[model samples]
Target: MTGFDPAAHLSEKLLERIRARAAAHDRENTFPAQDLADLKDAGYLAILVPTDLGGAGLGLAEASVLQQRLAGAAPATALAINMHLVWTGVAKVLADRGIADLRFVQEGAAAGEVFAFGISEAGNDLVLFGSDTDAAAQPDGAYAFTGTKIFTSLAPVWTWIGLHGLDTTSPDASKLVYAFVPRSEEDDGRVVTRDDWDTLGMRGTQSRTTELHAAIAPADRVVRRIDPGPSPDPIVFGIFSVFEVLLASVYTGIARRALDLAVQTAAQRRSKKTGKAYSQDPDIRWRIAGMALAYDPLPAELASISRDVDGRADHGTRWFSLLSGVKHRAVTMAKRVVDDAILVAGGSSYFSSSELGRLYRDVLAGQFHPSDPESAHATVASAWLGPIEP
Candidate 1:
């Protein structure tokens, strides 16, 4: 990890290439194949793997910064790639606590294998606690998964997908199985990739629906089977921490881009009646300042929380409250900033082809991710007020 800088790795030239393809990918609703390949070739995928395993050995702090930079250039690419990083980041979290269970994920990522997150399902809001997918245990201890996963990002290229399901057939009927299913065509075509990713924005992510037909996770690969619902398990903590931090980083990046574009637009566009640039208008300047004000605290909070996760700084039960709060704040701030930016950019930005317009749509998605506004509010309320009587 010596002398390793994540920013230097994602060079300006690389970002330019990614940025150039973003519009085309969005317009065509295609996955960013070239973007993923370039990031992999640049060793960006192994940022969280330990140095002993041929990776940068970076931590969540570095990953958060890198995510912000990547999202600024191409939000969809950053987001799609985030699922893979979350696994590796979680591996790092576990390793720091002397738990070597997920080391394989780190190794595989270092080896250029893409890992997508498949925890999301249609109308299932239990998140990490419970799953609608079925995981039937075999004699060999492996689990065969059968269910549909919605918003499976990096669908076209993932080598492994980390998912969870209910294992009713196991000794413990309440066991919630957590495991990785390999992407293969064997076993009479085990996994089905649905071509239904058309969306308002972040179109290049290709986050399609997946139908699993008894896809098996080998015994050795079956990571954890915790009791359904929340517990103090490392798997739960790891996923929540990594997912929230990285997701927040991506949205913060979007806000940064929108704010920058607003400044640029204001500097160029003029007030026809006043015979002056919009940048000179007091009202426009105030709007830009408001955007900046909303955007300021998020990156700092993202950095601090990520470093806390890396350092294993103890927040006890308050961690859930903290993580959810940061995610909610970042998303809300980003959305507000983007809205203000659109006002600054005026009518031209309203066009479909405008970057701000795309960002407007992408920022809306932040509301739909886990730790959503409603969930975040509930988590925070529970943290302070305690849970209501059953």
Candidate 2:
């Protein structure tokens, strides 16, 4: 519940494994098998678990720090791990009332199985907007979830799923609660992911779409009722902040790799006009410096918000709104920074051979997650006054 310093808690042995896997994992677009195994063995997947339980009981601040460091090298691995951790994090949010399947997710986190969220929909620009999809309650103590869910990352690699859906009949949107379910079913595939993730970005993420068209058994449903109307204000806004922080970490890591690779490869890049090290060229130096200018100062700024969020201190109209502003700023800055890295790294940055290229693609995907800058900014502004619509 307290006194957890994620900066200090990170295991060097585990990091070495993540670093070791960074190349081949990204290259082959293979699963981050080692990183996931290491994280599970380390028991970090139980992060944010209730203090009453035997968990470390850490806060978002600690988790964010770990994510920033571990993910920067291998985002695919970091993100795959996050699928479980975020599910763990959100499960705790709903824990007060008791989500029956939660204990399963908790034990799974400890035992090495992971649960992923199924929210995105097909044809949606930014995920988290909820699908045009809808659900209905049935007589069998279950609901027939018969809509498509897009961008369900880690689907191929997970054991359980946490999903959010809409019940058109609800009176309030906040009532649209999140639920937990299994990835497999002898009855039918309660959850299924489409194989549409083959792309130029986040190759290994396996972020594909899914269709839920089976009986969501009663005891299996985490939270089945809702009063669909307006959105869950501070919670929605706060989730945005959480996502932005993670997205920024992904890009920052990519940019850091860009700089590192550029510096290392500079020596071999000779001038076309003259035989000279590219590292010594002023233009090349300036280009790389620009990336540095953008890369630094992001984490501390995100960290700064922790002081406000933890204390619920002075800020915008609501605690979450205040974080939204910071999230937007961090994401926007990361976008530009990586663009600069891409430009400086040259044509190579566009090829899979170059790590920066993959980094660039994954970072680009961050811009579209949950919501984009435009929607995020609008949401923050609306929050200054009150909750947002749509």
Model 2 alpha-carbon miss at residue 119, Å:
1.5
**Residue by residue across 247-279, what tens digits does model 2's lDDT show?**
555555555666666677676687887788887
Could you give candidate 1's per-residue lDDT for residues 1-390 as a string of tens digits? Answer: 246576577998999999999988888899999999999998999999988998987889889988999999999999999999999998898899998999899899989999999999988989898899999898898999999999999999999999999988755457999899888733368899988998988898899999998999889889998899888899899999999999999999999999999999999998879999999999999999999999999988998998899989999989999999999999999999999999999999888899999999988999999999899999999999999779
Clash totals, every prediction: 0, 12
The number of clashing residue pairs in model 1 is 0
Best by TM-score: 1
**lDDT score of model 2?**
0.63
| Index of the highest-lDDT prediction | 1
Score candidate 1 by lDDT. 0.92
